[model samples]
Target: RNDHMLSDWFRKNQEVRIYLGYAPEPNWWSVADLVHVFTGKIDGISPSFRNSMTCKIIGRDYSAPLIDTSFTVAYAARTSSQIAKMLAGKYGLKLNITDTSEIIERDMYQNRKEWEVLQALADLEGFICHVDKDKTFHFGPRQESDEEVEAELYYRSRLKSNCQVDFEDTAIDVYNQITVRHYRKKQVIEGSAKNDALIEQIGQVKERVIYNSKAKTNAQAKEMAQKLLPEFSRYVVTGKAMNMAGNPNLFCEKKVAVKGCGRFDGNYYVERFEHTLNSSGFITNLDLTNLRPDTAQQYRQDLYTKDSAILGSGNKLGSGTI
Candidate 1:
């Protein structure tokens, strides 16, 4: 393509590294200031021989294969961190995870994708999983977003001109109560969590019930539901906060607060974001909550991947609420 030797040299399984860098203020830029943002492999390449010759290339982050490409494995009452390490090591990726005491019940993926199993485990424990540019896999409880940092951003909105809301969306899945029912050795066990304050404010209980949970005990089931209560509370205010006023630090998995925006004033999880810099200056775009379809797909697969029996006796297994 481009008649450049390197551009046409792409082949299967070749490593790729990408870095993002900028000058630090008035100081001259150096390689030390660069941040490694992506590491991947050339999973595919296609050269077109048309009138205007061109080429197409596609790849994924390095940890993708490590997480998504494995097969048959089993775990019985294994701890969360233990399983994470095992999976990472299997693929030769470095593991960076917070240890968890949560023990997962017996499970067999039956040759399913490794990510499906990990995602199922994550949902059951109300945790999260991700990887870094160095192929370092991470798993554990989701980190709490800094409210003070988010406050600083909203405060700067009045001064910055480009910071304006571009789009917003709200999900109807917001609920005050989450009920989880699972089959425990063929007996139905149930656990539920309630947000009394939310129910009171809404004037009624908006409930979401999930069947075939992976939780092994009543407490585990309840804890899974409890973790979702606060997340759903924030859904009422989910929406993209137009252009943020200042160059504020923002990233996925972080929480941002929008204020002085009427009913939209509330904390929201920054699910996705984009940053652009040019002669026009820097711009920040954000996607909050379920505005993006990937979040919806993730929820569907993560919550329902585990094998479970039907809600009642003498019935067949089927997909349940996620």
Candidate 2:
């Protein structure tokens, strides 16, 4: 099954690296976004604590440049999913767009890249895009669950090293009034959805500029601003958690609770995560943010309900009574 998915393009373009582990089995291969280009030992040194294998892993998104193909798009009224499909189709990539946005009279020039255009559309609609393990491209919000804390990490106990949190209040990140100008349209659209909240917190007016978009109406521009306001509200708390034990389920876009510290003890969303395993031990590092979940998605709750029903039912093993 896996061999069938590896086409001639992938075999020729994708990088391959061999890692010799303590096993009698043959080499294990996986198609990740990035792979190891080189792996071996240091110069004039045998395998020891300081002389581990030196592996260079490159990012898997080498195909990003391929998606940078330029083309013109003159859209009168088009949904974001349709535009995304057109972009993904250019590179023979599959898209899993769970949400959509709308645009009117959008025009794309030859200079702009398809990835950049896709990112712009995603930003306008509060969505994200990334390729998955199965090479399926996903476009949607970061999925969340009802669980208050996805995992727990202690500072001096679970963590091998120290953890630090930093606070930022840059004016460029937060704004009250945002004026957007279309590339071709003559009208200027202003969005002040949370003006009162901004004044109450910062006690002053902060203006931001968002110009040269493809929006064709005041409504579309306002919608873009409305979505951008919450994202740019600059009261961000970010931190680095180092040397935690390995957890397979921990990754970006998940929430975790941090304690054992006076000032930085709170719930944080994982912005980045990396886990590595070797002969020594497993290490997990995390980059977390203060963005909390607004509400749990319905699908997540449905999964819990199904789990409870299955566990509570007292039927035999294979009675087909799930």
Candidate 3:
């Protein structure tokens, strides 16, 4: 009978609520703000013998419902920045994208969520997409700088409870040969790009092939391959570290440097970042990836670029991997 009663009680208290105050006070704000709802399952419950129940929580984005919409559109010769504006119009969102001269020849987004479509389009140009605190959509190139506060890595005293370092050297997917086949100008055009250094190091015959119809010509396919080859020709570095600073604004797709650790000390891009805020404090867990190799990050300024012929630029527009 006691076990049954306890189970009933546990189920009742699992209801979700927004807490504003700490214990011994009028916690769990009686008048909750639905606009700023923190939606998550009640993970745990503990009573401190004072009729006060402490709730363990997981943070969730409440704005997810906004971007979940179906749409279809055909775009031509539109830069990433322009596409961002068109998508953001549905939600009256202000679009802020990195300045780019790269232009898409043609793109068709079938019936899909605006969020998913935006991300897919951005990936074609090696950009990241996310909404910021101001509710602005940031669809920009991966800002690969160590100076930005959002991109800087804190070491020694800044790391909180847990820190982990990992690396994968035997990346079989890292390919040196790329063959892109497409139909153009009333005929089939084929182009290939190869990483000479990777071929020399691994062997001459390690080939990986792909078919891309996005590029209008054989030269465009070759250019696309050149931009992509460097990104795949490397072992991926990933790790998770806690940020004691509690920067609530931190989101995924930002870069950070991992210093003090030998070999692991390099610039890494955050693929996933989860920020948890509670009565204790804010804790951040990061899934990081080193897009560029150690030496490449320092000296390779023009990593990828748009063809001058397409954009009418005398020089190549800066480019990088998605």
Candidate 4:
């Protein structure tokens, strides 16, 4: 009573409407459309086409619909045949008999051109030339032997008439020319700057010496100050001027005098003046830090000699009295 057999048949063979149109005011309708009108559009119909009937219900012609389906099928079959032939030819299977003549003619032309190029290349010596995609020639290696120089020359002359040199060689020549020009320009600019700097340095040294005098002192102090001033000036020229200007802490300072002689403590030459004062029979003490270390030692030894001479003179004078 459930009709399982009927439901199984409907599930296996589903029915679909293949609509076809009739020509001359082309119009058509499916079987289901007529059936739906007759059955009140309520119950389902069986999926079997065995009891199906084709009814030419007389509203419009259906020839246009038939012609359209036929044309579509024919076009699809022709396209598939063309695709199959293309695939066979690509795989070298010769699917179409008519394509052989054209393929052989193309191969023959290619082989003949390649053979001519090989012969030309084999005949060259002293200079070998090749043609590029842009139809320009390049010359480098020689293919023929040295003994075949005449043949090589003949081939070279023929190639020269047929091909022009490549743009690459022209570009290389231009690049080399530009590089040489750039190098010469750089050398000229650097040389001029160096000359200008030398002149400026000479002028600065002259001005510095003219404006400043050597520190006034006896021979030893003068020698010490002279050695120290240049190094100090270089520091001032390159360093902060306000800090090193008159800052005596950055340099050595000294004052020296005999007890009886008036103070000879100017800015410099204290040690030499003290030695002279002590030799003249006055006791003296001199600060020696104004001099460099080696110069200070030498000055101290001179002062001691002066003191010993004075004491010796005083002892001799006292002995004369006794």
Give per-model TM-scores: 0.66, 0.57, 0.53, 0.11
**Ranking of candidates on lDDT, top first:** 1, 3, 2, 4
The list of candidate 2 runs beyond 4 A from truth reads 1-12, 15-57, 62-68, 71-77, 98-101, 108-110, 146-148, 156-172, 176-191, 194-204, 207-234, 292-322
Best by TM-score: 1
- Positional deviation of 315 in candidate 1, in angstroms? 30
Worst 10 residues of 1 by lDDT: 313-322
Model 2 residue 20 lDDT score: 23
lDDT of 1 by residue, 231-305 (tens): 655443334544543233555545565655555555655545555544565556665542221232244442221
What 10-residue stretch in candidate 4 is worst by lDDT?
Answer: 172-181
lDDT of 1: 0.56
By lDDT, the better pick of 3 and 4 is 3
Count of clashes in candidate 2: 2
Q: Write the per-residue lDDT of candidate 4 for residues 172-290, one digit (tens) a residue.
A: 10000000001121131111001234235444322111110111223433353344343222211000011111111111112211111113111222222111111233122222211
lDDT of 3 by residue, 1-322 (tens): 2323343355422434332222333445334322222332344444333344343233323225335566566556566567667777566556777654545445445567776566655554455565544556777654556335364554542553234444433444466876665544337666788878878887765554444446668888888777667776665455656544444434444567776666777877654555556566655666565654222211122222223122223131121111
lDDT of each: 0.56, 0.50, 0.51, 0.21
**Model 1 per-residue lDDT at 309:** 10
What order do you get sorting by TM-score, best first?
1, 2, 3, 4
